[model samples]
Target: MNLKIDIDKVQYDASKRSLAKVQLNSLWGKLALNRENYDEYAIVESNEELWGYLYDKSFEVKDLFCGTKKALVRYKTVKEYNSKISRGVNVVIAA
Candidate 1:
């Protein structure tokens, strides 16, 4: 599967803690599935180390900060994680 990371066009105002609207795509959906299947796939922590495994298709990790397990799978970055959470999507870090 192909994965792409796209940032929302609208910048989040750190001071205000407001976020811009975002649209989720198919690739993102696939990522979500991957995240949800962490239990079956054996997800892990350690972002730096996980990259190699993710690239090799051996393992995966979702950094959702305070998100639910489902949201973390689709989101690949901290920003994406936060954006999904802001939109009411539940994202959580999982291994």
Candidate 2:
């Protein structure tokens, strides 16, 4: 017995194709995301917490805006937060 499968000859409904495309794109986008390149925003309520992020060598403070009860910090990690941890953002294989 013999069987053949041709992916090029297969046909799919418009809705099915759209759904598959969206799912695949989302999967790849998540894999390609680099957390280090993105900045994080946090609402620091205490001077210790605010100063901790400001003085840390690993983090680069972008902006500081003070509010009534808290301060908003926009910062990005300049160095690896944890040397033993892996971000799992594999851009090479995903591309």
Candidate 3:
């Protein structure tokens, strides 16, 4: 048997990987087999500190999602980390 693949999907992921040096991938849904209650994990390594606060986990998270964990964290350079921190923003949703 032969399998068909979507070339665009592969290219999209490749581009995302290249641009998103850091990614937070979670597998809680895959693990629990429940997609409705699944949450997303984020990888953030933009600016070194984002004004010297977030780099060290200074940002407080209230009612945090305690069911998931970070899968991977990547950083191409300290400069990239700094840039992400300085220019990036995260939006948290209550579960």
Candidate 4:
């Protein structure tokens, strides 16, 4: 699947100072760059490490963990006290 990622909306946690949030609407569309059978994988890291990963890879997916309500609740609980704080969060892709 072709995906687009918005590098701007990605945010890090205030307490842990790690990648905490991602805005999905910023991602415009997912286009098929090429019809090649290349293995697709994602390397998850802290906000600190995200820059490095972005520099190395052409495309990456953020908020893979917080993509679901259950996952967001669990992840938010570990990161922050409020689960409601994570509402409206979304995953975006950039071309």
Candidate 5:
């Protein structure tokens, strides 16, 4: 991602902070550019779909652990949690 940023040399607002834009492609550029695209892998697609559900369904799924523990928590496979999801219930696995 060539995040080419255009920063204002001087403060652009009363907050005395430079203005930045994330420059998303549009129209023809959007069609031509592959800047934003999703992978077609099975697991990746499943994870993406799950995230979409969590966000769209308004489920607040967040955790605070460090290192390996965090990774484990982030993608932990909880049998009970899976059952809860199957029954259409919101879940937040406390770490």
Candidate 6:
């Protein structure tokens, strides 16, 4: 597959080449993202929502940062509860 990043119309430009390389690397990094290492966050504004995540069996709560108006819950799905493959991840596409 041909992947190209358009750079400034200059011959042997170090800056332009560096920028293009960075762009390409970032693209690859995003495409090969590890969903298992990614954490899902939610801003809970109600007591009900906060308690829901705390008691949720489908998710493993990692951290809880509480604020006055809203709270942030950082969590990930329980492996046992979510054994299915993620929709955003595809081994063929990543390959």
Among these predictions, the greatest TM-score belongs to 2
Candidate 3 error regions (>4 Å) = 1-32, 47-95
- Could you tell me which 10 consecutive residues in candidate 4 have the lowest summed lDDT? 69-78
Quality of model 5 by C-alpha lDDT: 0.33
- The predicted structure with the larger lDDT, 4 or 6, is 6
Q: Which parts of model 2 have CA positions greater than 4 angstroms off?
A: 1-3, 6-9, 80-87
Comparison by TM-score, 2 against 3, better one: 2
TM-score of 2: 0.76
Local accuracy of candidate 1 as per-residue lDDT tens digits, 5-86: 5686666586554332222444345334444323433344556434554464433444433223322232232233333323
Give a tens-digit lDDT track for model 3, residues 1-95: 89999876765567778556433333322233433223333443334433233244533322222224322232222233343322122233111
In model 1, the runs with Cα more than 4 Å from the true position are 1-39, 57-95
Clashes of 2: 0
lDDT of each: 0.39, 0.86, 0.35, 0.36, 0.33, 0.83
For all candidates, the clash counts are 7, 0, 11, 6, 0, 0
- The lDDT of model 6 is 0.83
Better of 2 and 3 by lDDT: 2
TM-score of each: 0.18, 0.76, 0.16, 0.19, 0.16, 0.63
Q: What would the per-residue lDDT of candidate 6 be over residues 1-95, giving only the tens digit for each residue?
A: 99786676536979999999998777666677768877999999999999999998987899999999999999997786447766666556545
Q: Candidate 6, 6: how far from true, in Å?
A: 21
Q: How close is candidate 4 to the true structure, as a TM-score?
A: 0.19
Ranking of models by lDDT = 2, 6, 1, 4, 3, 5
